[model samples]
Target: MKKLTVLFIAFIMGFSGALKADEGMWLLPLISKLNMNKMNDMGLKLSAEDIYSVNNSSLKDAVVIFGGGCTGELISDQGLLLTNHHCGYGNIQALSSVEHNYLKDGFWAKSLKEELPAEGLSVTFLKRMDDVTQKVLEGIDADTEAEERKKLIGENITAIKEEASKDNDYTVSVKSYFEGNQYFLIIYEKYNDVRFVGAPPSSIGKFGFDTDNWMWPRHTGDFSMFRVYADKDGKPAAYSEDNVPLKPKHHLPVSLKGVEQEDFAMTIGFPGSTSRYLTSWGIEERMNVVNNARIIPRGLKQDLWKEDMLASEKVNIQYASKFSRSSNYWKNSIGMNRGLEKLKVVDSKKEIEKEFTAWVSASPERKEMYSDVLSTLEKAYADRGKDLKAQSYLIECMLRGTEIIALGTRTLKLEKALEDEESDEKVKEVADGIAASLDAFYKDYSVSTDRKVFSAMLELYYKEIAKEYYPSFYNDVVIKKYKGDFNKYGEVVFNKSVFTDQKKLEAFLADPSLKLLRKDPVFIAAKSTIKLYKELYGKVAEARASEAENNRLFLKGLMKMKSDKVFYPDANFTMRLSYGKVGNYEPKDAVIYKHYTTLAGVMEKYEPGNYEFEVPERLIELYDTKDYGQYAATDGSLRVCFTTDNDITGGNSGSPVINANGELFGLAFDGNWEAMSGDIAFETQLQKCINVDIRYVLFIIDKYAGASNLINEMTLVK
Candidate 1:
């Protein structure tokens, strides 16, 4: 493994080779050594240091991890941030009410005073990253036990973090790359005073909703704006009236020049997770077990939520964010399964494994290291198959599916604290914490809606999952007491559980009695479900430990075997850079996709009364008058969305699509449905990143919303 690392470094530094346009999520620091020449040749006008630099401000300074999952970019000196609307949906929903519904009507801060403070929302700037593989793996060798190696690695990582953050206000994490074949220490400075600046209404932001979520020829103006504020000393601080807008070290200049066919494009952001290194067996399990389990239950839940949402506007506002979050991945899973089968990814993985096996057999040393890797993975996945499925169902149905159960589970900690030390202050502290969370939880929660979803999910769990795998409480409470009636069980739980009523919960918390909590049906069910989940998680953990060790060896062996191939690490929500071009491809026979879509297409598809196709009156008036202002394309058409061959996944949402000159041109929000399988296997032909054109985002902000304050903050380039 050490030799392989040396060779890998040598390979990266020594080669002045051309890069393939269709693949690779390259590390930013390695850009100068490994990718600058290729990128320069492809049309990059900036130096590698211009992309990522430690000595000076660069593009890296402009990008941040938006909240927990998405990516955002600093587009103005005043910390004006740009991300996808969906990425900000939760905050938007949180701030929304029936009277002042931002989700439906949209929001634009006319001034800094109007910018709403978003509690608990944050943006983390990457301070720097260091290759810490040697430090992390110190005193570890081939003979070390997996558990011991992990402990050593954990200790080293902790020590490194402590040393790095001694006097600095930074959060540090050591992320393993290439399936633990390499490690990097990432440092981030997090700003907690994030504010909501602007967003288009859902009619435009989420135009097609579920129907066109992952599809191409997209026209959604899926962009949102936010701002980061800093304290008097220009440092991150909690929200305060005295805080000023952050003066960013580097902010992207927005380009209205627009993109063309094969125009050089790149996306810089934290892509969440990609399992491109998974074996054939892993892909099968993902498709049949994980994706299947999520898709079915979520689809059922969404259907129930949708019916309720459409029936009442208040319910619609309440459930909008939750339904969107659930349905987005549910649709993605459906598309991924289709793409996986259509692309024959499993067979392709099998072929690769055959090559890997053959390469290992060619040398005794390689055989000793990697001969058991494939077999170990096969057996581990095979042995854990039933449990894995059970775990998935358990999480989807019992934990994630039922709102009351999830809410009740929160009390377990309070119950434990009460049991251990019966102090009034401690009880009050726990009760207050629970009380603080209840408003937010119950804001979107509907008893009637959740009851229906609970019943449906429980019924599905009972019908689909094995009887033995059901939570013991289900058999004990539902079958034995309620006579196998899920509806009756749901009714009883909803009616009796304190979790169902905020007032009841508050009253109970005022008294602070563990006896009452232990007897609570919802709490009882939660305890049972959690216990079973932990037991199953333990089994899965054992399997994963063995699998991880074998996978590391396998990755190391594969790297040695295919030393010629440039191996990029699988995404783990760390910063990565992938460069490509604005181009399009055919999904199948006789169907060609263009590089971009225009507002004309949006109007063409517009049906005034239809929920998915409705266009805002102001937008329609702008289109009718051709009032595109300075944001229109050369053809006088306003480009709403475009396609790029850039590699992206879930967490890449709101990632800024940069041009050769490193100007922000688009916001990456989704992937083409035809290439949903790209996460597991990059389908160069069909895989395309769906991005909202920066011009359209500006058009909506400036023309439709008439929010000149936002336009004034941005650094626009023609």
Candidate 2:
């Protein structure tokens, strides 16, 4: 690959090499050039090519983009997969029901025949990657207009992606990097038939639940198992009885040898997003507008969901995934806000910006190139605050928070089809698609719980957001008729709307008519809300474009200004490797947290009737008997979870924590609460990757659950 361009180089000038091991989510393709020597210095035994090689079966082959968002690793020749229990929580909940409540209890498939099919779940392996920045910006220059630059880049990406997948069945994507100053092409091979093999129940898997979700000194056994299947010829295929377990190119050798403080620890996974390059204005917007919207509405909605879930097993099974998904980030937003404030992240960013400004003012050439970058970004963000806040509240309060509104939004396609006077066959195709989805949707839906969510979320939106951001229905109907009582309006809509009842919806779809659909109150609200959101999006688009272009220029110049220091690209759901040492941190004055937690800690937190801290009976029995088998540390304690300084974010969940010899010792599940602000600003001293000890995973499989079949298949190292 062509090296980065620069007008001049200061050549380190006493700069510390490569931003330390504890920071940076680095690209694999650049590891050898940028990070190999440093990694080797940190005690890594494997070569860079051993970890990521396009031509050979390397560690990359063992990793997959689990489902849509998290990471998973192959553990056995039979295609057995392992990831965080919370990462697989949604699929597990989808497979559960009141009759066979796997979420409350647990599931263990004794043989291949018994593994449950995870219908919507899929695993994707990265085939390779290529640098395509030169191609993407071939004809672009300083004189090019913003719109023209965007169009040319888009065309170049399309051509690059087309040529990359010209004669293959691979999924190829061209993603921008370094704030669109550079780009890369990623290729992936996706398999559709993934099956659930085993998992510990919530008591163990989600031991601390929300109370301890993003906290440290965690004792959760947060691991789950799945298996990928393919056709006899080893090609990706749909779920079928004839399909056999995949014989993967590589699989991780699980290590019962365990981990210790200061040992080499590394993770390779797809981290979702980070704003390490984001300006101070952006940080403020993230904290006040985006997080506030989520905190206020989601917390209110989740409380309602939790009440119903506690009252009935059916409701619990139905809403478990939804609640988990909502609460995970709701609590995250809370913690992130707290961290940002406590860490003074905004002031830190502003100081950097001030330094950048002074650097630019020194030279006329630099002044011309970077003069308006900061001002442009400041004005862009300042002007769009109201629109962004309105959009965030709109999304959290109605679009996502209310189940029935989300379900109702699905009918827009059918509505458009009928309005456009499409052919009967074409309309039937659209209607058939909606009808096919209903079974799965209604399977895990509870009308009573959804109605409560609808009422609470709608009331919050109406009272909190400005009138101008309100949907058409609130002014046209609610204000005029119900005196702006959101609960009454919600009740009327739920009572009369077919979207609230599956049978009624199916009947409406049986002989669907445009007139009847328009008459529905839920439909009106959904349509209006979506239309307003689009309008809000449009209002912010221009400012967003200005901000994006300026941000790109700012980064390009900043890289130039700090040419001696190595810079890693911010995360954007791409495979990245982060290495650090396994260690502990002192979060506060005179209080130090240890590097790891154990089964004894799990027992200490156990309360018989407490939902969040409840320990399963069988797990308690094993702990009392000290039946940890061979998974215990040298001191005879069963290590549950440990901490590392490896930089990670949301999507890094389920990443395998490999040791110096490249053997799996832990599974990265959560990041410690002290460094929740690390996504925006890496906290080297306080940031820690909370991981579930792989030995604990083995112990649970071999001793607690008696699923020795899984344990026997894995290649364990002592």
Candidate 3:
């Protein structure tokens, strides 16, 4: 770790951190850094042009964005796409009940006809992209205020989208990359009405929930299956029972050949955001304060909520998604905090600052520029502290509410009704809107969610912050205000309080006789606070944007360092292509990931009593029989491949790990233990990615799952 930091420090100063100098190398800036080139003789072959030129037209056809969900890719054309099971867990859970229990039973369509249609799911592909930075940032001057700049960017994007899609079957979106300096208009064909093809039980999909999240030597089969659907004409359309299977222009072939160390591999998918370009102060704040003080504590509340849910079946059914969501972030924060700690990011930052200061002392001109840059960054970090507590509170407050989308729908109906002049028309529209909204609101939102969040918020306030910072007698006031009046807050939130045994909440909402009190003071205050928080959130977003621009300038330097060195900008949750080969890693003192896990490990980790890692009897039995056929490994596991270096993050889950021939060899699941810090700092020495070998996934589909009928649709190379 010391050497790691020292090497990084030397690189930062010696290489001048010039963006262009390392161009066309495997060492991506932030989104993903190139893995240690153990196979290429510690050399990088892929150029910036190769990376930037990769597109739908360049890669195998099987890779597709799961669309409307997290990123995923098609490993086989026969509708056998592999994605992080958690990504599809919601729909799986949504379709499951105590009777069906897909999460427990594991859904295998058995046949194409049996594949279930997921109501709101969709898949999208980026057909093309054109740089539109000039248009998006056009006419913007140094004097442009944040709010005005945002509005202008929005207006320009709208216009660009309209013009770019003039003769295409795709929808156009203008994206900001490198902050506001670079923009790309992405044209995509969105296919709605994707169906749930299959999935291993939670035991296979999410084995080891919180207990094993973000840890390596992992044995989780976090894969889900879905199939895209379209109208009979093969065009994007709304959900219909009669919708036909989508015929894609490109779908990657399953690579039975496997990925060996440093074999050329790449994943073209949407990788969410990264702030590798941020100053050391930014990383320190995330590590020491923002993520630790705020995210971790709130995450603990969710854990508590889940524990509460599991204790009661009814609560489990109601707050399942809330619990799952909370757990996800909780695990991520844990990993993030650990990475920051292990790397001693704050210490590293201080060292870098000291070195830079000393370097600046050698030259007057350099000293002035260095001072100005540090001053700018310091001011930004200082300003970020003012609203930290308030912002954290705002998230907690919203977590205890109804579906925002449903709320938006309700607001729209109310606005329309208020605008209508005709009594009958207004009545009809309002009634229909209200009736239509009932199921979406009731089914999607859990009443316990609000209870859990609100209680957690209260606890967080007390547990984390200083009492003096809070209003005088805040605790006493809350207790007094709600004393013997349980219905007050409950009625405002869920029209009733499921968290308590209060029967008066229903009476309160329905009582027309006391309608004036319906505008409860507490409810009104909550609403006003929510509105103010939202407005403040917008300002925070703008401020973050300004800081992002400064960071981009730093990154841009990396790309422009020297000619002949091409650079693929690190991912920003936009589609990116990272090419590498299958490989094992040697993390300090001979820790190695020789081969990937198989279906056997799925059963090995299963604990019948533990919901997080429990494997079902059927899956265990299948694994014991060596049912993998051709995909079976000599090492005895399912034969998933390993990689030493790749840049990926949470959003990159289910991204297709393609081979040099552009065949789908593996579905990227997670990064290795050493690479945990890759999210914050890309250490080519430490940043290795773990991918589920495509062969294992295919074997599951063809043999155990019995969905081979779908396999006929793909163009299999082997």
Candidate 4:
């Protein structure tokens, strides 16, 4: 393969055409050459360099990868970070209990010292990016065997990543693009000392709960604040009392100016994944196999969790984040399947495949290069269907359905150290880590709750999947020992397993016995489940390889066949800029959804003592008095949330919505339900990015919380 020069990227991305609407998640390094002119024409006041300059502190410096998959931006020079409240749900829930339930009631730190350090929370900054296609695919021609090609490419990527991160502590990754036709090397700097600052209660932050998620005219105040702390030398460090708040290189100035219809708006975020170029067969498999797995098992598990949560506040706080995490994707799967069928996406893709097949047949060279592409993809998807379903079920039901399996898996590291006859100090290190984490794990765990979930999920797996795919223990222990009753097996396991009780786990850590752990019921069951998953995955590995290569080939051919069409690579969890305008959409006939929703809408949905729609008394009093302070629109109405056409998906949950100038106006949180299929297929007219108005965030911070010290930290732009 020849080098994909920077000039080539500019030519491909900078092309002028109207192939589609604003349907792109563009890489920033080439934005100046590709999108600056179009962005300026759409009312942008800042240059591409202002948005993404690696040499100087720019807007990219302010944007960080919050937690694992979400995007966050620095709001003040003190490294005060702003992200979606849902994105911070796990951390808040972890720190909550019946005594101080931050998820039920709100939380605010009056001063820096009062801010609580969030465990397992880290923020990552993109240091720089480079086009490294040539470096990654340096070896071989068309004659190279597929396995050899994969092995050589892996070796090449490892070498490039090692070389890039050799001199600095920055993490490096090489991401493929255009379906492996291009590659980019990204460098990131991570800071782990992130502290929880403030958040509204679920009543406000999660106003509508499950019903309002992925819906339009949203009134949720989905915003949260955190502060990044570093060592005295301004270097990233572990949490410590001596650490100080980081002085960010650049921070976004808050804008009180409200959004208007057709106003230019943009969002930069780390969108997780998209299958925009997926084949029809793949789509069918996704809907029937993969998503079906998520829908059925998760739906069952969430129901069990909700019952316990509603019965007791303790269980509610313990499983708050767990339930939210599970339900978010469960609902998304349902909506996506419905959207895909409604839109006839499979039929449309079939039409495209027909076109590609005819185009390939017209020329001998094209035929030789692409004749088997469709057939190969079709066969791979067909072959992997059963195994894929089994794999997905294994993950949702056996692996993630219950918490005990994950807990059991965590002990493997200590087991491995023990088995290898490593140094006593090494074994002690592993044991100590597990001991320290036991409190945190059991803090949110409930043996009864998990035992119920365990029985139901395993039953579902047994009933749904083929008998051949059952975990080895299920047939042996569940059938022979427990008369095929998963409930009986589950009850027995939880009753006897050391992992079920914190004190038992602590006792194990003290003794450090290998024989006992090997005999542990939970460990034995987890190992069996994991072993089945691995075996299934290995069975479909070849099909996966074929599918991937064919997908890449089909895309490469499609790009060349339609050279004049404007195309942007699918999102791969990288920092990308998507430019669009703030606007409303008509979800159906005779119903035009408005661009924004105000506080009155929240009040309209309010019900007395209702879990989902209950209004706080202080908020109601503030609404009655019309005391919105400095955060109200000129018409004396306080807007809660708004909508935009900016292209975004799951990992974009906490992205910052910026105006024409480089100032924050809203926080991007969810996508409207009408466009749930946007990830697989961009719904140009119906898709909308739902965001909480920045003013509402400020209003809650000032009047509701009265944290003036926190307010003073920001540079608000009037």
Candidate 5:
């Protein structure tokens, strides 16, 4: 702890003069020394220890990693957890049926017994974190080759993790910070018996859908509730009928005090990734190649799926999650490209690089280390550009775009097991695994829907990518035999392939044969595409590796050159804290935006039968009667959502937004559209985090849904 204290002091002394108040995703352990004073000035009443402490219960005890990618916070001692509705959308959809379409009508558990178990869902609590940098880089330095350096670091991380978890059930991992310049060991305890408690319907949860996904003045409820369960002994365990609600160490008291403009606000959660240190060449490649690849193909696929989904209610239920997932990113890519180009982010990076290069040339030692960093980046990106589009198409089309391909590839491992003549027991195990997976796989799968997707995406790939990069089967089969008629090709494959039908696949697996699998049309196409992708990937491996090393060195050099500028590491799905104020901004000239939206706005946007804007009958009744209960503001308006300047990204979805007294006031959900470029380069003026006002969450639960049982579970503060 003393060593960490020393490191914190050093970091603050280096950059304190230039650090902006609201710009960083800071490490929690350094808050007492580096940030407490400023936070106190901003109206924070709690000490740093109240927010984070390794040896006692604190705010960190309440925050949990939701599912695989989002964040959740415990709101009650009974382990009542709250997160964004979109974060729980997949589970809600999975549990839905045409008869009981929860996604459309919403759901609420009247009692603990009524809560439904979400299979395979889990929540994790971070126990503590320790700086392990010295141990991780013990024998590695400037002279070490990239390959060897990686190998040594991997070994060290494994050993450290093993040591940390020897006597506890904690899931431990060592993560690199600052591009491997620093490392920390994090420990987490995971609970697997999480259950779905309640959620508003998609109309409210996803009020704007794709249209208002990342926009401001949002009125979406955007929240869901779950409960964690533990074994009789109060320890982590798999699902069991005998399990009970967990008595957590800490849970946030919900605040009814609400928010005012410039009120102190903070968010704590796991952010997925950000490449803020990317050079100009990297930014160009991302904008042109990666973003374009995602936006174009996904949009095409979504259009076809949307038509099919709208035609039949059952089909809509089947494709709801898939369509939402695809369109979310498709819209994001489009927004990011627009933001980058409009904001001149590439020009900003170029100017930074120019300054860095100039600074490097002035010092011989720095020149030796960083002289080739920018050159390496430019050449690597240029080389990668040759095959980047081809690779994207392969992923979007063959691997992801076509459902039959994914289903077909699942049998490859069993085929390999048969080829190796594994034991009968092992063979049965593989067969059983495939059988279990098919139930969930085919539940939402539609042959006709996927057939259309395959045809459209395959044609797009064939027309857009070069022939030399095409998989062998494309040339030998589709182009050669079918005369490049992807429609006919899709028809034949869907009708003839065993992968399209669960019964057919099961029968084939019962009496498996390698020859049959190898001859299957879907499997053949998948194999060919994967094989070609591997070959192409091998070609760019060296250049990509060199680019990584050079980028790491460049970051190291830049930190020294700009010693007075605060530097936070790029996000890698790790927990971080960001603080700011609840403030509004002008996105463009003469356009002033407010800090919050109210229930009146939701009513204003309501269209009787429109999917994205439809309001539930009960919600309309409540609005018409002004029945907001205790959740309405001083002006007798129900606040729906608000904005904050806190830095956040993708995985921060569903994060808790706490006030100065460490009470839950809102849930962080989306970033404003004008600042989609925030991931690559922070836009101080335009970057704002949109949050669902916690009071709005309660209003819907108590008044609209009549779920007072949930209201009783939380500890509310005025």
Candidate 6:
């Protein structure tokens, strides 16, 4: 694995020892409710006063925390917003029917009146978070059962909500961290009125969907625009034609001054989660047991999906979206596992734990809990391994191509069931159930992209596993039905299977003659394979359980290692702030990255015919003309920057990259290839985050697209 050049020594020395007790202290100082001086010193150029003066008051107003899907920012007083294009792709797809494919052509509301309101879309702003560790874990002890512990925690959170709401109007949620070592009461204001404003074509936003995901040197413009809507009273309300654009309290200023090497930077958004505190045992299991058992099968599924995509257009339509998403995540796991192996993250964690355990041994009270924790974790891994395997199997087989067919059957069954049912409520329940499943079923099977992966995995399962497990379809089945040779069978069943035709299958299920084929040899073979796969999955679950228990022991040791000295939990898919300076990277002996990328480089990477690097003609023309005026390229090109030490994960997509002044400089998107494991472990040296220069965003908005009306609203700081 490549070593991180900047913070290698500091990270190696262990976070507790290498970092000051409050190295992240400069992040949130207590000088005042909104301290400008401290925030400036910490790397924000904007003062607390500036944040407040800019229509936003308090951290709550300035930092809007997107809930459920992903985090985004309110960029306009009239509630114009920005987020990852991938995040908004679903809505765009939903709006697009067969005749109007917005995803293919892109969607831009010519004016505010043309904006489309999407049902169920929401945006949440964090109003406040008070430390509630004591309140949450008041009576909890090491001996407490997991279920009892869960119940108590829930009750305490409910109580906290009741108390916090006495005079204030907000929603409260108790968040857990560091294995129950800490808790926070988060108060939020959720807005349900959000509309799709604009989006670039998927060809640009999702360029190189699988090819460039998790790999660096990326050129994806993964961004989209939305607007928050509110009633005349300025409070959140359900979507209605009468709703008006929202007036936000805070909106980030577009900074064209841009970032330079070693410049201080920070990302303030909700991070999904990480288990950097897991035990060496758990890490090893993830690296080996989990990855080996699940990731390979997933890759096989993806391959199958690709095959089907090429074979049938209908399959492409039904499964393409789902396969894209599934494969996108699958590749992350593949890279994460590979990177962990290269970085020896598991080994490093073990070494760190060795020192921690030794220190804990000095204290009698701490030593008493040590062995139990380790033993419990070991048992948990053995117990949980099967569950992990089961999940993988479920996603690959039962939930992919075949599952949707089953779903279509259920839908038809419900229609038939309702045809005879007299009770309106029961019929409604059945109809609703089918509708709910249909919504997911369409996305899940994504016939266009995912069928090949699903069917291929089924075939591989039959071929790879022990012969005893698939007796019926092992030797004679292949010989009689598929010519006995395993190689030919694999090619026919996986590489050339006709099941990839989603529309045909749907028709067959609808046709009585061919519908019975749904129960034919191929389907029966897959079903039997799934049954066995599920049993093995249970074994994997047991292993994961043991591993999780072990991780708890390891985390416990680290807590004692720090002993009363404060350190926040690693990450928990919750909002977190990581601060560091921008810097170049030496990925290898001969490869040195300058910590920035220019529009020229984007052009260099562009290949007109290649899907991975295709540049739009308009964007290329603008770049050639040097049309960027106020949003001029910072370094004489489209400025894409890199940073050395911000911890983020999947959900941090489209997070604003801000300077010490809190000025928006870029949008956080991809991480470097060497740092793929940073999703699980943040190595400051190897884990540099790649971002889209805010300048490029502005230039595209101004010169390329000619949306000056939108550009004029931003508080731009050139």
Which parts of model 1 have CA positions greater than 4 angstroms off? 1-4, 12-19
Would you list the rank order by lDDT, best first?
A: 1, 4, 2, 5, 6, 3
Name the candidate, 3 or 4, with the larger lDDT value: 4
lDDT of 1 by residue, 382-441 (tens): 989999999999899879998888888888889988889768888888888999898888
**Model 5 per-residue lDDT at 357:** 91
Q: C-alpha displacement of 315 in model 5, angstroms?
A: 1.4
Name the lDDT value of residue 348 in candidate 4.
95
lDDT of each: 0.90, 0.89, 0.59, 0.90, 0.89, 0.63
Ten residues in a row with the worst lDDT in model 4? Answer: 2-11
Q: How close is candidate 2 to the true structure, as a TM-score?
A: 0.98
Model 1, residue 608: displacement in angstroms?
A: 2.3
Tens-digit lDDT string for candidate 5 (393-466): 78887788888887877777888888899988888788778888998999999989999999898899998898
Off by over 4 Å in 5: 1-9
**TM-scores, one per candidate:** 0.98, 0.98, 0.80, 0.97, 0.98, 0.81
Q: Give the alpha carbon lDDT tens digit for every residue of 165-273 in model 6.
A: 8886677778765565557787778899888888776666776677777655666667788889889988988888898988877777767787777677777667676
Better of 3 and 5 by TM-score: 5
Deviation in angstroms for 133 in model 5? 0.7
- Kindly indicate the candidate among 1 and 3 with the higher TM-score: 1
Error of 3 at 194 (Å): 1.1
Candidate 5, poorest ten consecutive residues by summed lDDT: 1-10
- Tens digit of per-residue lDDT, candidate 4, span 98-162: 89999989899999988999999999999899988887778855567778878988998999999
lDDT score for residue 503 of model 2: 86
